[model samples]
Target: MAREVLAGRMGLREAVRVGAYADALADRVGAARHEYERQSPESRAGEEAEARRYLAGLRSEIDAERAPSRR
Candidate 1:
């Protein structure tokens, strides 16, 4: 469970900062997994391909969300 003692005391900006840290941790974990797969010769090519596709999809989704609507 998350320790919410400090969370109650934090302001909105601080809470967003905490969330940003959590997002960063997720990115780091993904990078670590990619690296581990990269080090294995047999699975390396397939893993790298998967990682590229995953990242491309994520980027495209983020871009779409950021884009302004035509209406």
Candidate 2:
């Protein structure tokens, strides 16, 4: 991507900013994976269930938003 900037594809400032954001996001994902891997099996199961519930709630909210409004 830095090379893309040199090739006149994107401005240097935008490329640097985007690269920094991607790096930060990857770091966060790596940390989360590390933490999850260190958990006990039972704890991991509980975490998975909780995540599922949270995602289901989000799906419901999105569905409600997309529904047509009643008069």
Candidate 3:
């Protein structure tokens, strides 16, 4: 990507900066979201449920991979 930027590839540098900015923004948002969720017990429960729902599929896949029988 840096090579492409140095090779006079238009927009590559800006694109990389934009992607980096987006990643930083996402990290900030995630931190703020967790902090917001931690502010109230009820809200924390709701947020945890929402997180579990989101992660359920991935968790199932991972559990399947790590199942004791598989080991």
Task: Report the poorest 10 consecutive residues by lDDT, candidate 3.
Answer: 8-17
Clash pairs, candidate 2, are none
Off by over 4 Å in 3: 1-38, 59-71
Candidate 3 or 2, higher TM-score: 2
lDDT of 2 by residue, 1-68 (tens): 65777799888667657967568667889999999889999999998899999999999999999999
- TM-score of each model, paired residue for residue: 0.45, 0.62, 0.34
For each candidate in turn, give its C-alpha RMSD to the true structure in angstroms: 7.8, 7.9, 9.0
**Local accuracy of candidate 1 as per-residue lDDT tens digits, 31-52:** 9888886686767777778999
Instruction: Predict model 2's lDDT versus the native.
Output: 0.85
- Candidate 3 per-residue C-alpha lDDT over 1-71 given as tens digits, one digit per residue, 9 for 90 to 100: 45556677745547457777558667889999888866888877888899998799899989988887842
Error of 3 at 64 (Å): 9.9
For model 1, the superposed segments whose C-alpha errors exceed 4 Å read 1-40
Report, for every candidate in turn, its global Cα lDDT versus the true structure.
0.74, 0.85, 0.75
* lDDT (Cα, 0-100) at 17 in candidate 1: 65
